[model samples]
Target: MSDALSKPRSTPGTEPKPPRPVPHSPADDIPDGAQVLLAVIGIASAIALLVWGIPKGYHWARAQDWHHFTQWAATIDRPVHTYLAAHTTGLPITAASAYVLWQGIGLGSLALSWATGATGARLTWIAYGAATAWMVWDSSPATGRPVATALAALAWTVGSAFALRGLSLRPVIVNR
Candidate 1:
């Protein structure tokens, strides 16, 4: 009776708990070289456009070459100026030139946004979308070309925004 009472209990069927997954910190996500590359590409493209496009537009405007201006303006897909030019004489080269200048501003903004990794890139997309939409709407009475242009611009803006957001989320690796 004493031996039976002193018997030890034995139950062995349960498995051990598994380890949890490691949580990633921001620092772990983005590499420094990637960040620098993003900044460089954005800034370089913007600078190149500003340097090339603006001067050419200004020269065209100053020369008062309506035909060349009209041709270039047509490439932008805005209906108001193109339509007005077709119907009447003396198309506004100054206005078209101004529009080109605004585009340069957008390019600069995009570069700054990319370099700073701020919300600036998002803002640039919004601006680009707005401009593209305006052109589409203005050209609605015209042919399908303007609509296609608008769609293309919309795609570009959305793609760029995604790219920028992805870059922002990446962790910047610090070298010690």
Candidate 2:
């Protein structure tokens, strides 16, 4: 038989060949615009909450409108409470304590998101996810607005996750 024919054919029946390591390309490694978009979404959402949400909350509080305040609080607090209640039951804790804990977590995540790196992206995902959950659960008169905000937050979370995963796959060359 000819050498070509005699040579052992590397076919499906034979042991599979080891995958060749692909040479890393800087272009291939770099993150796309999605990361920036996600980061921007996170920042804008946080700013909105701090600017509009906080003031609204304060207004409700100052007015001594317990009903409105509870509704507002539920919008911001209920999701976190629900998450905590589901995940960490049996722990002796008051609603105030839970709120504090959730706030701490949100703040920490936000801080990390501001810092440059993969941690920032991961933090953005977590912070946005929590915020989205909160908005969805809270019973607010501005229900339509919260729905839109929650959807935006969810988009940010998913986008950030994709960006972070992409970054992990290869070194991203970000333009300063």
Candidate 3:
């Protein structure tokens, strides 16, 4: 008998094996120094902003006159503040309070996102940093502190760059 006949008839169809998947490890989620710094900076900045903003928000909420609140908002010098002031002319104190509250929430979320290494946190952090940089650049000259302002802006930019680089890193978890 021929070798084929001796071996018995083989099936016409056979299942193909799938490629092996790469192994996943907890180490894959470890962030480097820059990412760690980004998280720390983001959390600290968020806390500071919240501390500074909360009282202002409370004051706005308690104030009777929206006009006064809007005026105060306009004086803040930030483009966002100015726009809010211009557009919320007839709104109640809640408008100002809501703006402040919104900032608090956004900052809080930003902090959490960085800490957790959330998927979109990097872009959000970068945007926040850029906005902060712009605000510093816009207002610092008036304070007569060009050098400090420049350094602050540079720091924000660097932080944003760190966030950008950290986009792919995930949150580290402890083994039980």
**RMSD in angstroms, candidate 3?**
15.6
Model 1 worst lDDT window (10 residues): 80-89
The residue-by-residue lDDT of candidate 1 on 24-111, one tens digit each, is: 7886677999888989999998998899988988897788848865654455555544543443456556666655655665676666
Q: Scored by CA lDDT, what does every candidate get?
A: 0.64, 0.62, 0.60
Alpha-carbon runs more than 4 Å astray in model 2: 1-74, 78-89, 116-176
Instruction: Give me the overall lDDT of model 2.
Output: 0.62
**Model 3 Cα displacement at 125 (Å)?**
1.4
Candidate 1 lDDT score relative to the true structure: 0.64
Better of 1 and 2 by TM-score: 1
How many steric clashes between backbone atoms does each model show? 2, 1, 0
Candidate 2 lDDT tens digits, 1-176: 78898877776767877999999986675588866887899999999999999999998878784786566545545555555566556778865687676566555554455454556556565655656565455533455656644654655465555444435556779998
Worst 10 residues of 2 by lDDT: 134-143
Best by TM-score: 1
